[model samples]
Target: MKQKVIVQLVDTLDLGGTERMSVNLANTFQEQGWESHLVVSRQSGGLQNYLNPEVQVHFLEKKSFKDLKAFWRLSKLTRKIKPDYIHAHSTSIYWAVLLKMLVGSFKLIWHDHFGLSDQLEENKRSEMVILSKWIDRFIVVNHKLLDYWQKLLPYRKNSIVYLSNFPYLKLNESIQKLPQFTFLNLANYRPQKDQLTLIESCKILDNEGFDFRVLLVGQQVDSNWETQIKQKISEYSLQEKVRVNGPSEDVTSLLAEVHVGVLSSESEGLPVSLLEYGLAKLPVICTDVGNCAEVLKSGELGQLVKVKDPKLLAEAMKHSINNYEEEVGKAQQLNQYVLEEYGALKFFESYQKLVGAVK
Candidate 1:
């Protein structure tokens, strides 16, 4: 039997959830005995180092949306690779669809990581409708998106699958713990991430005499957003309480230094950061957004607060601190759930089935 070939398509490896997922999938596919290749349609970024050594990576260095040269390069590369399947992540689906039209027959799967969920714009929906005929399959991170897409493409219901995001951590049992009530918010600086809300929560906590620190780890993708966050941190006198670090290659190492994990995003899909927190066995406090409640098992596994509510977020943080032992136990339970349900073997099996059914 011939080994299967899969090429993962992504815009960049920019140290975000979708970028990390693309890298994880490529690595997982290679581990599952497939000839895995990763194609970056644009420039590379910090997360590129996470790609498995066995996986081949190609970069098109796309200049802009109208970079036809990059598209031509991708088509040529696809022809050379002759992959059994081309799994496109998010906006990269456009490139893959165009490649199929220009080149030849190859299974194209679109992995939707859209953060807006049901609130996706009409223009995007119209575009999807036009591309629906060319896309062979669809993979969504949450059931809400699955339902949304199912309604959008009633005729293609059979092609859509809902798969949960899994952790991509390399576990270490001997990590040294930091000596503080450290909270981690692992999200890029964006309007949707709502870092300002988290900062406000921290201010409330500080006023109530809670001596804790927050580590914001992700790319400063938007300069204006970064400026606003820094300004808020300064205004709240949270310079000592909050540290805005750019993306790190050593996420596991960073997780070791924190006692609690947090996600105060205004919106999300099934965030991989939450999974990483579980894998690290860190007690979590996240806003009730996207599939977070589902992942946290409706607050059974972790603490869930309402979005943009500083008082509620502060109270949750206080609760987690006061009930540290109990929260640790819950964290352990979440870790076990992630390992059992989202383990590499199970993920690979589901992916194999999805790919096999594509034809």
Candidate 2:
């Protein structure tokens, strides 16, 4: 029998990229003849829909973040599972390290999905530093993060691996037939996501008499960020041009319908949204953040505008629309690039190497 693989996440219900990717990876493991288990601190999010019957999910009712009782519960659970590998995503790695120390058996792999803006905060940096020594491999989404992890945790010299969070999006036929002039941005409302910049840029386009509709798709992660975005839209009277749609599982379908995909994030870590855009053959406009420009091949696949610069962003958006056919051809070429580089088979191959190195 193949060894069991365990994925540990802080919360199971959240529909964030990290959680969704965790579910994807777990499902992949199952198809490869490995038993998959998802262990989470809480049961409270949108993850239920993504869970496979083959993958068992355990939600431990922890006392609190600082409570020793929670630690004990986690440790006990880990001991019972005796997983071949314990793959941790985000801040959960910190606790996974402690649990590993207590159980002292399963191999540890740390997958990073958080963006550059997340690393700027002192508290998060300190936490990464504290947890650096305990993990076996540091899986980053891009070279920038790999460098950051190396500097922060230099002892793990050969432990870094680049694993982009690109998923296999099965496009729905219905959405593929939607009308053009629809642009999509899939990100939870957050300052770092910079939806305000996108809206402002859209306002510029509207003034220029561009024929387009903007679809902002994501849930309100931060209430203030959501409120600020709505206010900006109201201020610009962009209600006619822009529509804010809440988070939807049909991202590929949405991408299929749109002519252009835009992300004006102040920071990111190889956003899956861009990858989804590429797969759907939609021309993309993204700010130069994380690995977006790199994936876009510095405007070969899509245009990269400066973050928060509405004028540049507006110009790029218009240029993309003006050169629609040519840009989409480039997008298709980029789609092939992603299929070769970030596909599930490639990701699994990289996973094997990391697992071998640690094992």
Best lDDT goes to which candidate?
1
lDDT for 359 in candidate 1 is 61
In candidate 2, stretches whose alpha carbon ends up further than 4 angstroms from where it belongs are: 61-63, 67-73, 117-124
Model 1 / residue 81 / CA error / Å: 0.9
Using all chains and alpha carbons, the TM-scores for the candidates as numbered come to: 0.97, 0.92
What is every candidate's alpha-carbon RMSD to the true fold?
1.2, 2.2
RMSD to native, candidate 1:
1.2
Please list the C-alpha lDDT of all candidates, in the order they appear.
Answer: 0.89, 0.79
lDDT (Cα) of model 2: 0.79
Residue-level lDDT tens digits of model 2 in 162-195: 8887676677646554464878888888888999
Displacement of the residue 86 alpha carbon in candidate 2, Å:
0.9
